[model samples]
Target: MAAYTQDAILLLGDSLAQGKFDRAGLADRLACVYVRKMDVINRGLGGYNTDWAIPVAEQVLAQQHEQHRVPRVQLLIIWTNFVHLVNMVRSPASAYYSPNTRVILITPPPVNTHQRTDRSFADTESYAEAVKEVGAQVSVPVADVWTEIWEAAGWDELACEQFLFDGLHLNAAGYEIVFNSIMKIIEERYPEIHYEKLQTVFPHWSEVNVNDPRPSLVKRRVPIV
Candidate 1:
């Protein structure tokens, strides 16, 4: 295993979060933007809801004792909906609590019942709203993806096909919205960790002196606000 040389932005959620097939998925976009600044770890599991996520989080998150060896989770982005999951990390009594870690809650995208039957439009909408409520209760930032996509779809359920591939999962267009929403949240809530504000772990090649390249290649700790 690679040594813990950088902090991480851990992403946890359901299929919407996993999105291994979508090149424009949230994880992919975040990885691209956060490269060299922070490692973006995707722990998104397909078909997993809040209930299934609880047990999984315990395993994925480092225990208090393991803090010294593991990369610190500086930012956590949860695309799942549930208060328990949020409290598990934010609550002072929880074992995984990290006071320095910032959290961002993301609402699920809108569902179009017409193209999909397993889920209902209203049900998904409720889940999205619940995420926002949890974010408010815990004082974490929320990426209100539901409302943003709904508006992008012109408030018409059927029109969501422009972004969604099967009225359920997102396409490149949909992922773009998710990526934009996340970037906006980061800009407003965690400006210090923003990609633009952070310096690369190693100096740019242009800064390296030809006769003394070893010193410029040394990795440096990134300052976080």
Candidate 2:
């Protein structure tokens, strides 16, 4: 694999960004030769929107330079789950979209129509659009998750009772689907390439096993989706 001799990878975004859904340890499952379990940093703060994401990303990006690795940011995953928050920061120059980092915006998962009525669907679609617009301004790639869920199960089934035990977050299989979806995007775009950088090798996959007790939810899925 082509060596990305970088160590730090900051994943900054909202609840979905926190990656609370993927019990499969999705980030650990990435096929990046430059990145490994230890290298991927979960900077995802539950319930945060892009308004909050910018500062966190800035803080990390400002002092976060590398000595050995060439900054293996083969992928920087982002998702926006907050519209009210982004609205609060519309005119602020401190918004999340910045040119300093490589980025990919995952369309925030769709809202559960059954669980959310009262214009939540509008809010979610608006949020998704806002995310895409901001990412476009900075020339970042957009990961179309809106299509992913809609095409597969539609909002109702994707947000069905069995799919979400808590009526918000997905169960194990749901999480697996989410994780695989994101990874598949990365693999498709980055197209992992093998290279022998003298002493370099892929980092050890996470030691965690499937039987290990599941981790807690770091971020709540909006609208019980």
Q: Which ten residues in a row have the lowest lDDT in candidate 1?
A: 81-90
RMSD over all Cα atoms, model 2: 11.8
Candidate 2 lDDT (Cα, 0 to 1): 0.49
| Error at 116, model 2, angstroms | 5.3
In the range 1-225, model 1's lDDT, one tens digit per residue, is 797777899999988899857487888998898888889899999988688898999999877777668888888998887778777777889888777888898988899888997888888888888888888887888999899999999999999999899889999999999999988888987888889998888788898998988978888777873
Clashes of 2: 4
Off by over 4 Å in 1: none
- Model 2 scores worst on lDDT over the 10 consecutive residues at 216-225
lDDT of model 1 at position 46: 94
- Measured on C-alpha atoms, candidate 1 has an lDDT of 0.86
Name model 2 segments beyond 4 Å from true.
1-9, 31-38, 64-72, 81-101, 116-119, 155-167, 193-225
Q: lDDT at 54 for candidate 1?
A: 89
* Top-scoring candidate (TM-score): 1
